[model samples]
Target: MTRTTPARPVSVEAVFPELAAHRSRTTRLHPRPGRPGMRDSHVGGPMLWPADEPWPVCQEPHRPETEGYAPDEIRSARAAGTWPASRSWPGGGTPGEGGPVPFMGLAQFFRRDIPGLPAGPDRADLLQLFRCPLTHGSYLERRYILRWRRAAETEDADDFLATPPQLPLLRWEDELPEPCVLHPEQVVTYPWAEDDTLPAALIARIDAWEDAQASRHGREAPSYQSDLSIPPGWRVGGFPSWASTGPLTVDCVSCATPLRLLLTAGSEEMDADSHSWVPLEDRDPSPHANPTRLRFGRDRDLHVFTCPADPGHPPRWLLA
Candidate 1:
């Protein structure tokens, strides 16, 4: 289903004209419960893999979690209808039948599909992501195996692997992305003291605008730079919607260069009972028609980072 962005009380641009320069681009991948095609741009969507190529695998052994079951046990429990909680993991379990599919998509990004990204080798824009499902710690953070392929290489783009390989997964499934249809929106981002180190004068001006908004609205709204009001799901731009460790900035290990925000894979699309940004027409508000069914760890947001100087450099993952 197409996503509906939240509505704002008033345009920030109307308040402070100078802040308009600070805007950035962000697209929310609104992935509802639907069948995405092999060639579609989506999370958990079918991959454009070659007919003869081997499906990727992760070899890490699964250890039992104190409260959760192992990879195999989880699958079995799901099949028998004994699993706890209303839903488990993203995309709400394999296809229509709620059993373990054995693998999860960690992260996904496209060089050509996205508007502004540094070029890579072969002059062929690539579509990259990861495959992993096993957990490593008490939080059950799943690891990942990175995969990158030229978007131009697959011409026919037919034939898809029926089920994901249940083999061992790698050590870092950084960000979990669901199959989603992107609703690209271009809007300016608010400058904050944390990520953007603005001069004292600019910072004061931002504070003043926020104060005015709070006074006008009769309550404290989210700060200008904090959680810049974007729709839920996997988004590419605006500030990240932080839950756990708040905001963090990491530098690339290979070159020590500061990384740019690549993607924010969120669990749920909108906050519970939050009518803000829920679309003007959505009277039902609880869940969309065909829900995406994907969620992050404990309602956390998984952020993927990459170096702008070299896209091939090892990217970093941060939980916010």
Candidate 2:
């Protein structure tokens, strides 16, 4: 036998006042798009507040006052030898004798840029921005200030055998280099070898094979082949012929899967996003270098999106 449960009584005070009053308040209080709540006030529209209402006052932080200098003042200072300039130390002197002397104070160099006059130079100006064409590595030039060996002429040569320290003078320039057409993300593999191991035996075999094939054919072997009999994604062009049989294997950083090798013949035009380049025909031997074999792997990161109806879906409420 099953037991029956009694129903609980409902209280009038527990009911919502809006529903109990029988007065239906329309959600559309304002005339606007969709379900009206608050309309966005765009510029050129009529003001919401009264015309006499005081305008919202913004309290912004006060900037420090700056003094204006005339062009003649700057020119006169430079003409009178008051302007500061970096000068090299004079030769033939004791250590730290003619090292670095303060040429001018900071106050003199920190001048405002005048319209007609030449712009005042800043002390911390950069000279250049050097970038590698291949790997895009940045390099800076450092000055090695060597001191004269005082004990070289004497009996003891190692007396003055101190390591000379280098001074790093950061060089930067206003002009920027052309933006890199191919980003590192677009390229599959870095051109440089991870290790210094050279394939000596492989190189010898490749040389011998190319010579025998060329001599037998009476001309250079076809650099490119369009046959579909080759492996998937393998194309013949600038890639070394021995590369197909080479034992080198590149694993993907994400999935650790071996990538399909594709040899692009020439510098191809890339997409707008700079993600990939369009494949072009086989490049000429004289102009084009051997194509680099790049490894491909899958990107393992998962992309998540929000469910529209269920706002509190999943472990947390995230829109993305």
Among the numbered candidates, top TM-score falls to 1
Give per-residue CA lDDT, model 1, range 150-261, as digits (tens): 7666645565565555523222222223355544443435544443444567667768877876787754465454334344556675556544664566798999898877
Lowest summed lDDT across 10 adjacent residues in model 1 is found at: 167-176
The sequence of per-residue lDDT tens digits that candidate 2 reaches over residues 1-320 is: 11111111222113222223322111100111111110111111111222332322212221111222232343344346463232232332112222331111000000121111111112221111111111111322111111111111222322321221212210111011111111111111111111222245533443464466557764434211111001112111111112222334434434445332212211212212211122222122221121111111121101111122331222110010
**Could you say which candidate leads in lDDT?**
1
User: What shift in Å separates residue 139 of candidate 2 from its native position after superposition?
Assistant: 18
lDDT of residue 176 for candidate 1: 26
User: What's the CA error at residue 3 for candidate 1, in Å?
Assistant: 4.4
- lDDT values, one for every candidate: 0.54, 0.20
Task: Give the Cα-based TM-score of candidate 1 against the true structure.
Answer: 0.71
